[model samples]
Target: MASPKLTWNIALAGECMAARPFSVHDDEESMRVINLLRGADLTYAHLEMNLAHSRELEYPNRGDWLGSFMMADPAVARDLKWAGIDIMSVAHNHSLDFGPAGMLATKKHLQEAGVEAAGTGLDLEEAREPAYLETRHGRVALISTTSGNKPNEWASLGKGGYKGRPGINPLRASFNYVLTKEAAEQMKAIARELDVLRQADGSTMGTGLKDNEFSFQMPGDQSTRGSNVFTAGDHFEIQSRCHPRDLAGNLRSIDEAKKMADLVIVAHHYNIADGKRREKVPTFVREFAHAAIDAGADIYVAHGWHWTLGIEIYKGKPIIYGTGNFFAQSEFIRRVPYDSYESWGHDMDRLPTLNPADHPLHPGLDTHNEAWWTSALMGLEMKDGQFVSMTLHPVEMGRTAREGTITRQTGQGDHALTDGRPLLATGETAERALGRIQRLSKNFGTEVTIENGVGVIRF
Candidate 1:
């Protein structure tokens, strides 16, 4: 059932990596943020951490990736709901930290907390499907997928006699190394040195390098599997391309969702940065986002950069590039697996136990950086199935006042729950944050005007 005319408000938050439960406290600053969330007709957040019932089920260190294990108490789901988040996108790099058991437990918790979660399920079909949230104003459809899944983490359909993989819906991507002609020749010479280029037939493969598909791709030919090396003029850069199958699959879900709901929101979680820069949105993300909008997505939101990026207006709709991190308490997880300590080169057997603050990854891998601590909440309004206005309310989550540290020095035996929560930004902090957002959005020809303390995007 579709409404002839749609009018409502939606509040969008980037990622919630909360490692503990939260609630609407008595603090005036924090309550301002919560009140803003509750003011919207529909509220959304990306649930970037798993919900484990206990240490035994949620913290066995399940994920095999290089990323950290992010798991919060199952009760944290209720906190998100109480904080006014109606739906969450749970398809990010940290979603499988506790494996299927943890992921399933999280699903059950979200359901019990009365929160709708999309982008993960028992199989690819279910994962790629849209999850709808019913409201008095309208029915909103959410289709969430991620481009940052591990190689074996995709939810796969059962084939022949095998059972399906329980995981997140994947929107896969491959990188291409754009090299100069001289560099391309040098790679060919190295291939001659390594001897992994040629086949048993004695025919020379493209560039004659191991994983030659990664080493070279014929000019104008469609990019193939793996990372490809392309000689494009006299420059060196990394380019990304979305997997056609995965892109089409997600687009189909958007098309289906639009017909079923008054408004369709698509959330894409990607870790692919603009080269080594985490703040820049990748070209492939833009391409896929545009395709999604064309396929009937009313709004496109991206997260996983852990920093604010930019926003764009496409076809009279808003495409929020990245909103950075919210509820970013990664350093406050109660218990971590041995692998986390091992990643820091700590020998747990040879030494005493260590918490994240003391585990040598303190202040976090990116927390010390200013961008990682500052972000904005996107407030959007729509009427008659068209965009009305979009605003960015600046927010910050770090404490820079304590001896110039990213956060106040952590004391032993405390989770530091009160310190990492985000609140409404004001004064100089608000200006600096909104300034970065304005400059970034300018790259995409989107202008944001500072109205009071809020960043307003003029459509």
Candidate 2:
């Protein structure tokens, strides 16, 4: 029989934080102490406070962060659809930034605008369920999960909530920890109690637990708890180690999704922001992406770091570490500078050279504001079962053909040219961007090449 034709175009993965405009004066230096505190608090308290203030001061009428991006240019959303993105994963840390109300509004807007969203819902059950698409090829399922960094308060399926409800996937959590005393004892007692109940029922009690019983019990003491005690010989404790690439929950979701679809795609918001050359890829990325491929995922995409990171191909499947910013067009927010010692600090200015005269898109005095805009746009390509190619479209925040167009360019592909002025990143700018990708990928044993201002990662 001839092979089935794949109906879906592609699945784009990346992070789009709750949109809250900050003033141009909100620079890294201005918020250094706050950011340091934010790092110390893990809750992103300082960042949240700043976002809350921005919402209150800059967007009083908007209600939440969703309004700013929603009311901005429609062109970015239009371009995303044009780029063949049929589905999106909103399970990142920022999904609930504007609270559940903002998340729900985002979901509603995307759905109304014709895009499918996963990883959040009105309640836990809804959030756990995958978004099904009936494509020409076959049924496609998209599932998403976060690092649980966002407040659960904003996580729901109803109006003003994220995509899915909140619930722990036992299978995913099993790989990372052992069972606790309370959980293990609880499961043992439950099993004994169930046995007593079964005896009382006298309904042909079998020697072993039925598959249905196993399925039901597996999530509780039997699976997560049982495995924890049996495997680790200790009580369960959440792992403190940071692993960006670990895909435990993602893989489990994919396993369940595979039973209901022709193919499974996993999207996540992972943080691997050291941006330096190293001998090995971060432990989390390696474990998760590799495990996902082993579990039969067709694609694995992650985004959290604000810039494009790198890509890796494991067992023929494409695992994109970070796609940078897909539709991030929010300006007026304070742009935090990466520490001066960091390599990322070099490209703060839109100009390629140290001097301003050589770069036209150079924001000059407003370098921090333009830097974020200049670093967006990195797309993926896949054909059949293999990832074929990748492209980077340089985007700028400015007026488009239409009044609110956040215009992007495929390396000078279109748009009228200015008066013989040197374009941004002609030489030095391209080198720095590509260099960052290369340096970051060094730990992963991956080779990335920048051809005509586009960084390409090959397996």
Candidate 3:
């Protein structure tokens, strides 16, 4: 007799910055989205922002306000639970924005609201661990990690068993510029000077004064060719490799989850490219996703660019490059650090008077500007733990007017906190958004059928 056929539905969405204020009466659009989530046996979402109940800044703003150091209201966790999100990936660039306290607070609030979180913890090992959700249909496991993160945001293991440092799961990478022979020589001279000074102080890390192109050193290479920085020929190359320890740790976690759960989902946060354009994915991302599938991951979800990327099916597993933002309510965030304004050559007071459009670098008060505002929720149906069908439910993340009133308002515009929410796209909006997915996925040879404004994968 054939094995028992276990059937289940799973829904995965992009960044879920659900900063909107909770209300007793939710809008029709919000309810519609929530009902769709409820239809799935397991729903996974990316918790892009930390849930900080207070408006306090634990670390300096650092003047890097371009999608860094973000926090959200803790109350939003309750709303996420109400939305029927089963599990969330808590690892991202902003995971450690406010420090460990803030990160743990966000996790606590999410758990209290009945949502399981993964990709962050009290220490490195904990952060790399998987989060599991037991459903009537099957047990679902998720291992989450981020490719873009600050060094300080990386969790650490305490020496001598003291106490493990708190932080997020990090996938570190390196960059090297390729230049002509003449320019490479000049860089080597400078590197040598720096190396001499450092060696005088008993340092081992190469100053990059020793190698060029073919002679360039790899990170773990013990030979003298290794350099902290090096020069090559032609275009710049980014080492998209995951930190060795992190890669090993995550692979182990995936193996563990595979044994412990019936359905394994690996979620990653990586934005190596920019804008709403579907750029070539970094090599390391592809390697990691493929490795996860080989390690028994049934579904791979990657997000962070705030725009959708191409889709690939590897070994019968689905790898979604980028899912964009599911619920982008950044405009409604209650507070901003002082340095965020200082970086713009202005103070906090100037923010109120200046429109986001006028700011040199800002997500803008309008959330629906680019493809960042357009995204889709992936719905998968599995039979006997085998992929059967997948659908893309295109959604518009914005606000609507109340009757004939103007769509724009002071703080509550089309993308305000209370107003900002994900709504199913219909009519032309649906046509355009779903059509974009078609074009983005075309390169991967994935064809999708648009029916009733929803895109279905040919599978």
Best by lDDT: 1
Write the residue-wise lDDT of candidate 1 on 86-141 in tens digits: 99998887767777777778878998999999988888998889999999888889
Pairs that collide in candidate 1 are: 214-227
The estimated TM-scores of all candidates read: 0.89, 0.52, 0.83
lDDT of prediction 1: 0.78
* Candidate 3 regions with alpha-carbon error over 4 angstroms: 1-5, 22-25, 55-64, 176-203, 206-239, 274-278, 348-368, 399-418
Please, what are the lDDT tens digits per residue for candidate 2 over residues 72-131?
A: 222333333333345666665444544455455555555555556676666655555667
Worst 10 residues of 1 by lDDT: 197-206
Question: Each candidate's root-mean-square deviation in Å?
Answer: 4.4, 16.1, 5.4
lDDT of model 1, residue 372? 69
Per-model CA lDDT versus the true structure? 0.78, 0.43, 0.73
Residue 73's lDDT in candidate 3: 77
Instruction: Sort every candidate by TM-score, greatest first.
Output: 1, 3, 2
Report how far residue 358 has shifted in candidate 2, in Å. 31
The residue-by-residue lDDT of candidate 3 on 68-125, one tens digit each, is 3467778889888887889999998778778887898899989999999999999898
